[model samples]
Target: MRLPRFLLAGVLLAGSVLLLTELFAYRASGAVAFSIFTSVWLTLSIVNAGLGVFSAGYRPSEEAAALLPVFGLPAALAGVAWWAWPDGPTLPSPRLFWFLLAGLALWAAIALLAALLIPHATRETALRTAVAIFLPLWLALQVVNLLVGVLIENYSVAEELLILALNFVLTAAMPLAASRLAQRG
Candidate 1:
């Protein structure tokens, strides 16, 4: 999770944020919304990262390495939600709790699978590899998923946002657990 992984994560995050900015532009939220967004996101992400270094006893470099995926994924979900709906989404879609169930199940299954199957020496590398592979694919596939839901399924903004949130949780859980396992073992 150092040089190459850091570089890959950075590229992925920057590209996603750029796509988010574009999506915000596409929505009524405006380009100005993205400008304000990056400002707020940068400020919060930096402060949180700083807190991890100072209070949580995590290394600065590792915290920095983590910031992209930790924050960017949720933001990308929000962007897709915005693009899927004109007025934008509010918190907690009608079907949101179902995702909470599914996400937890996915987290457990993937973590268990990784623990059983992934080699101990390569857990970190495997985590990064999974993340690198999952990131782009998730975003691209979700775009199509959102479009289909919006156009034909007539999914509400809340429904779309909920799905995006579900996607975020499912994608993030394994990498998170793997990183922790790698750190400890």
Candidate 2:
């Protein structure tokens, strides 16, 4: 696919995921955490969509080049957001910069793993490989978070597990759905 078309797919995927996150957040928390969760989800969805498009059938050098935006865009945006709205509720403390940095590292790792694991095959096959590789890694991370009380909040263990499962399904589905649409187009 062309760069512009790939980017359009990324934007559409980001928008859809953002919309879903917003709806879920509103229903679950009665208010959207626009500055934090929504922003992070938007960044993840956009980067993941880009990864889905460019991960397969590319030379190593080209894949490295493609990874620039996948990793850089979110970090750049987060820095800009921190600069623009330093007093925003989501990032009231400077320490939240650490969270942004950690998120960047995690995204880079996930993208690398997906790119390495997905074979150069049909789009559907590549997407399936990605889902297979990513879901387990994602679940493992969630389990670590649960054990470490990273974002436990006030929820019971069962509720947190349910939420994690839902998130895993939705997150895994997004790139697959985007790839399907891109293939059809």
Candidate 3:
């Protein structure tokens, strides 16, 4: 079961966001910020990956697809770790990995559900039509997420920039790439 390229982008975006979250943690709310951003990063990954799957038109393998819901696992685990040991190093646990797997399953389900609800509508004209609908919503969500993250982290300029960069890279750039590939294909 080969993963799609855009899906890889989602994963990369998640990792980058996680790193950026860590970088800004001390400036924000100290150790607690790390845990909060960790969960946010995981949620973003799941959402982005689900979007990628739909845009790519590739179906996930049965076994792999079943594990989508667990994609949110990382965030859950991060929160748990923070709760369990407020002063300890945040170590990645097997439970989190399992949850991540569940997130993947949940993601797959969302993608599938979106497909059923929205229909393809990928024709050049339809895509152009939908762009009007999707772009603004996408940008809005990204910006809102950015703002919320910044606020949660206590208004760090660097964190805001990180969110902006992440939004551009994952939400904006990747979708444009997908649109181009879709046109070519």
- Model 1, residue 169: C-alpha shift (Å): 1.9
Error of 3 at 116 (Å): 6.6
- The stretch of ten residues in a row with the least summed lDDT in candidate 3 is 94-103
> lDDT (0-100) at residue 76 of candidate 1?
63
Comparison by lDDT, 2 against 3, better one: 2
- TM-score, every prediction: 0.34, 0.39, 0.33
Worst 10 residues of 1 by lDDT: 108-117
TM-score quality measure for candidate 2: 0.39
Q: Per-residue lDDT of 1-185 in model 2, one digit per residue for the tens?
A: 43433333333333333333332332322123234433554565455445556664455566557556654454454445445434332323432233333333333344434443444555555555555555676567556545443353555788667656655555555655655674686
Ranking 1 against 2 by lDDT, winner: 1
Instruction: Give the clash total for candidate 1.
Output: 0
User: Which ranges of candidate 2 are over 4 A from the true structure?
Assistant: 1-75, 85-120, 148-154, 170-185
Query: Model 3's lDDT to the true fold?
Result: 0.45
lDDT of 1 by residue, 43-113 (tens): 65676577668866889998898788655754564455456643433224433343333333333333333
Query: What TM-score does candidate 1 reach?
Result: 0.34
What are the runs in model 1 whose C-alpha is more than 4 Å off? 1-121
Q: Give a tens-digit lDDT track for model 3, residues 1-185.
A: 22343344334334433333333343333245445545555565555456546665545553246335334444454455446545533435432232233233323333333332244544443434434444575455456556765777576878666755655444444335545665777
Clashing pairs in 2: none
RMSD of each: 12.3, 10.8, 11.1
